[model samples]
Target: MDFLLEIIMTPAILACLKIAVIILLFAMPLGTLLTLMERKWSAMIQDRVGPNRANIGKFTGNGLLHIAADGLKSIFKEDTIPKGANGFLYLIAPFFGLIAAVAIFAIIPIAGPIGNFTFQVTDVNPGLLFIFAITSLNVYGAVLAGTSSNSKFALLGGTRASAQMISYEVFMGLALMGIFMVYGTTRVSGIVNGQNEYWFGNLVPMWGIFTQPLGFILFFTALVAETKRAPFDAPEGESEIVAGYFLEYSGMRWSAFMLAEYVSLVGVAALMTTLFFGGYHVPWLHLWENAPQWIVTILQILKFTFFTVVFCWFQIQLRWTVPKFRFDQTMGLGWKKLLPLSLVNIIVTALVILTLA
Candidate 1:
């Protein structure tokens, strides 16, 4: 009983609980719903009915049952290993992406500090670098799956993924130079809190979107491509390379890859919210200085959730709306265009900050 109380009452334990709540209860569920959301959204964009077929007897819940149906199918379906595959690497490849996707939320907070506790699992100093490092690990899943599968299509897909990650990752890091300059810290919480300040006599919040618009665009684009979504999806070219590196996977292994994709989709949105939007901050909440802490905390969580959903919706819409770029075009955009612009953005931002200082 005493140990249980320690587990329940310790501040560190509470922080862990918050992290679990955010990732398990929030991020995972949202990712699951987004799978349905993307299909439904694409159908709407294409002027057709969305998924409404998966039903439990009389209740389909407007295609919500598809989530369960998919889960069961992945579980009950036979797991297969291709001939000539590296058995150990092939079995473990799917988890690399999943691990990376879930790890990102550890440093992400859903709200401001509440009394003696914070709404995050860990508060390391070099948080943004941690994010970059974790994100870069996602490529391993593709590379391993492709190499181990022993298929020409998967091999080609893995090659594309490696090149794509290498190109975009450069500009992705370059793009953040401006934000790091503006905030003067690599800590994500610091950056989020820095945005809470208002400028022009409190008329506007100094959001990253306003200060580093180009960086936001570059970062988000790189992140999308990193997830191997459409438009930048040459790595998973279902038509061109037969589901890319994940083509040979079946049963829960295939499901794991898909889950990683959706979770990363959510991660992208969460990163955007943290770095650009006011990150769990309700704008002008300072006006209500007398509000209860519980109320304020609730409001912050709601604000974060709202923006996250909107961004998810936007990404889904973007995938359906934009045409897929050929592999070369995708590479060209990252190296030829975004890289140069990101360099320019960094130089100009530094000069501006120096002059202002």
Candidate 2:
């Protein structure tokens, strides 16, 4: 046991373990499960049982078998590259989204810090800016996939994705400025710590949602748009653009693009929990400052996971609940409506901060 502890308890090992815990245990598994959950949940919402065909010897496992069935089907399918397509760029494009999506988890805190060890992968000072940079790279996946497909439809989808993602990026950052100001720090860990603070002598927790309600609304709207989910999913509208930027991909390559979207869906949930919610801090848990560290940590993790899953389900529900926006209408909402509102939110936050000070 001491030998195992010596191997597992080092700083380097702990960091690597945190990465595995976040990426493999949490993000990837939840993201993969969501692909099926979306279908199942949507079916339930619309009064139907979703995808139960995959079975073995009279056992269906309900709809859970479909996950493995889908994977096996994708693995056996042919991957076709378009004639005259840029082979290199087409091959690499799918990874950009997946990479960017997976990277977002690096800064998210799953539980409060425990002594020298933290629940997060990295607590960088330029926390949110790093997020912006990573998210911007996701645009390259759509653009490259569309451009290299040698098809007008794919190119159009890519173009739309580029414009929409870029536009929402501005609003997303602007919406977050309020949180940055209210928390008085850009470091995500610091922000989470700040939210543990109560207002008016413990009457209420100072979660970002309570303090910056408008900012929260704008920020979440921007997150939905940024992920190119429903309403804002004009880039991939099946009625017009078919599959959009990834129309030509097949096999696991196609799955990669899809996985990127689902993974990003999970990433968005984590970010929402970290920013708008109180992160891993349980409401009033700090009231017992002398509580055992292990119990506090467990409760914090549970609270964080609960909020993240709720947000994920909420996003999926939102996709099915709202109708898709027209491509032009989508852009207009971002520029004319959300953009201005985000700016106003930031201005109001600054003034409020000054008044309180």
* Model 1 lDDT per residue over 1-357, tens place: 999977876877777787779889988999999988888888989999999999878999998999999999999999999999999999999999999998889888889897657887777898888988998999999999999999999999999999999899898999998999999998878888989999997789999999999899989998899889988999999788879999999999999999999999999899899989989888899988799999999999999989988988888888987889999999999999999999999999999999999
- What is the model-wide C-alpha lDDT for candidate 2? 0.91
Candidate 1 RMSD to the real structure: 1.4
lDDT for model 1: 0.91
- Count of clashes, each model: 0, 0
* TM-scores for every predicted model: 0.97, 0.97
For model 1, the stretches where C-alpha displacement exceeds 4 angstroms are 1-5, 9-12
